[model samples]
Target chain A: MSNNNYVKNLIESGMRIDNRKFDEFREIEIKTNIIDRAEGSSIIKIGNTQIIVGVKLSVGEPFPDTPDEGILIVNAEFSPAASPSFEAGPPDENAIELARVVDRAIRESHCIDLKKLCIVPKEKVWNINIDIQVIDFDGNLIDAACMGTVAALKTTKIPKYENDEVDYEHREGELPLVDLPIYVTIYKIGDKLFVDPTKEEEEAADARISIATIQDGKICAIQKGGTGYFTISEIERAIEMSIIIGENLRNLFKH
Target chain B: MKEKEKLIINRKRLDGRDLYEMRKIEIQINPIKNSMGSAMFKFGKTWAIAATHGPRAAYPKWQQNPEFSILKTRYMMLPFSTWERSKPGISRRSIEISKVVNDALSNVIFLEDYPKTMIDVFIDIIEADASTRCAALNAASIALALAGVPLKDIVSSCSVGKIDGEIVLDIAGFEDNYGEVDCAVAMIPHEEKVLLLQMDGIVTKEEFKKMIMLAKEGCLKVYESQKTAIKQAFTNIIDIE
Candidate 1:
């Protein structure tokens, strides 16, 4: 189905599929330390959607290009178990896009001081692997996953090392990553713009734009997806809305 | 004593657990605002998340049973969850586990209360160590509880394994791989009822009996932990009652 009528009905009523107003986001809930084995982990909930992110660390040779800095890899998997549409195999394009967008937000925002991950100069650096698993898909997985990732990273503590071995038993201090970055996704349905579209709105909307912002209000990354195109003015409007949402989210991580 | 020395001298055994041993266990729960319930579980690094959606309508004509509510389960692991990520869709292992979890849970749920409705349980494993399937079953039970889905019982589960020729409770990833026998059980403590019982590898009937006893002990311990967590979750909220 084209969902044209559904989109038109929602737009005409000045409401979203989930009955949210134009600029409102879905309800969000965050919980950390849900994964006991992960160095840092968080589960994020946006309405009916759920994403779990686990952060694990190990020592490995840094990339030759970024030998002085640590390496961060973000992998997002939308399992078939999450939804009926999701197929069995390697992550398809949707999963890849989700991971890349989230990766860019964190990396571009310079949330973690990659240099601090260095264990022994150019020889070894902490390889941080962020694994994101989508356990349920109601809608708007990107925002939920990104938020969960950032929260997990914020709570992460790189264990102290001495004499080429991790001091697992003894405790040293924690080094919190520097900046906190957040992402907000907006969907355009007809002439109306909606923040944090639900699965229904997401299915009905013509085009979607996700904008990630750092605390400084700088655009870290922007991805425009779906079949529809937006006017430059709409893009500007989305950015402004994202900034407001990002600021609100920034306050959330402060605690 | 001399036989003990022989086992430890080379630090190797038919089953790998040292004396006074247990397996690694991991637990996680994601509160998905979108879903009715959600949780992740890891046993010896075998990871799975259970998500529940709806006491909604029953779909497809034949699948519905009017006398009792339906419990539909899908158990799957992402390709990346294992050392080698498997195919994404329903694998044989997942299908089997789904059936096992469904059977385990059906015994505890009062399905007759919600006739004609359907409760869907989806479990996805992001990684596997050992006892992943059993851990997933435990996680589903907790997630359902968190969702506030009424049930007649709280199902708790764990695994027991034999290593170094002795029974050990809760096999960790390493111990499970090298252990002689692995047995997973799900039970309702209040009823003292066993829902699911599965075993693999090697063990005599006597050893199997011992393993069941040990697994039950582990299950009780896990049940206590689950209670603590549930209490803690609700502690801060104002009690309506």
Candidate 2:
């Protein structure tokens, strides 16, 4: 449509409504322990987008195959208050995609030492439940959620086990967090790339790629979304942008 | 009885309130400006919001009833609403609560007026400790009013329970979890008629009678606040205009 062409033309002219460069992120803010009941929690805001991540630790049996390691469950829910488009029922595909992408980044990057989370081997293990609640929606929900989850896990304090029983209210020690992995997403719009696209820009984008980089600057997870292709040179350029952007994001957490 | 010390101690509830004390209740009308009518209701730490839309049209035409408009209600809780990160979906508990709330609200609403149309009640818990369904029903009633729906009288809900061998008004999350015999009651004001009642755990018949009486007394207070919230909403509309 003519509207799409107008947006594309604006992007091609190196102009953004927000008056920022193509590879720039929105102003981000992060805070921890806003939720009173949860042991570990963080709230992240990227531009107008807001996400709160709460980490709950429970004692339960480990999986049969991975008996020695603890379990990590990540779930995301798009609250109806965040946007009019999101319904009040169960989480839909967008929520699921956000959860899976962030989960994959944390799980595959060897970020949290799951083995260290075990209590009595197979008999007892700590079950970590990381829940992402979309408080407000503007754009770039996945990146904000990922930051919140990581910051929350970093601040997580494991419950004390006394006499082989776990106490839910009492906190004992910090979680075994090994490496910090940062999530960076880049969108291709009208033969150009942009970082942290706003909601309107995202709707205009042809395709987007997300990369997760760990402490050592190595790519850990990669996901490509939307129905657009990228050339080899573009992919390399995106990777370079991710590395630099990821390092800045990594410094937000306590080293 | 799962954990006595966690709920009651020396005849006092965990939050250090008397047996008949209710958690702090707050009701703010029309929080979701995009919806026709909306309200955010809270009891102690638990919070839920209700947004009502439609009275527009019924989809597909087959499900429409000629005699009355339909009310489609969904009671949902956020994943971070609970301390232990509740699952992100409509659980059996939520489904049952939706039905119970819908039934309670249906009793007072003038549904027959909006023929071939439907109104949606979307109640989402932003936080949770206990008695979310009751709060949801209370908020939904206010939401319907904001939607300008016809009603006999606005409904209000509260929960009364027997804890430490004593009947109490408005049991909180920990009390409901560890206490015995939680009875959720929804009532129409002034007439003092019961609209919905569900008993969890067990109570003797004599104790049940006392609990209902206690719940009615609590419901009257809830009804007062519901009226106050609606008035405040009206005041806000005037201020906006």
Q: For candidate 1, lDDT tens digit of each residue in A104-186?
A: 77876778889878877669998889999999898787788889999898778776777887654443545458887787887
* DockQ result, candidate 2: 0.01
Query: Model 1, range B72-95, lDDT digits (tens) per residue?
Result: 888888788766558879854565
lDDT of 2 by residue, A195-219 (tens): 8977777778776777778877776
Model 2 - which docking category? incorrect
Question: Predicted candidate 2: interface RMSD?
Answer: 25.8
Superposed Cα deviation of residue B67, candidate 2 (Å): 37
Give the 10-residue window scoring lowest on summed lDDT in candidate 1 chain A: A167-176
Q: Scoring each candidate complex against the real one, what DockQ results? A: 0.01, 0.01
Interface C-alpha RMSD after superposing true interface residues, each candidate, one decimal: 25.9, 25.8
Clashes of each: 18, 0
Best candidate per lDDT, number? 2
Worst 10 residues of 1 chain B by lDDT: B1-10
Candidate 1 wrongly placed segments (more than 4 Å) = A2-4, A167-175, B1-241
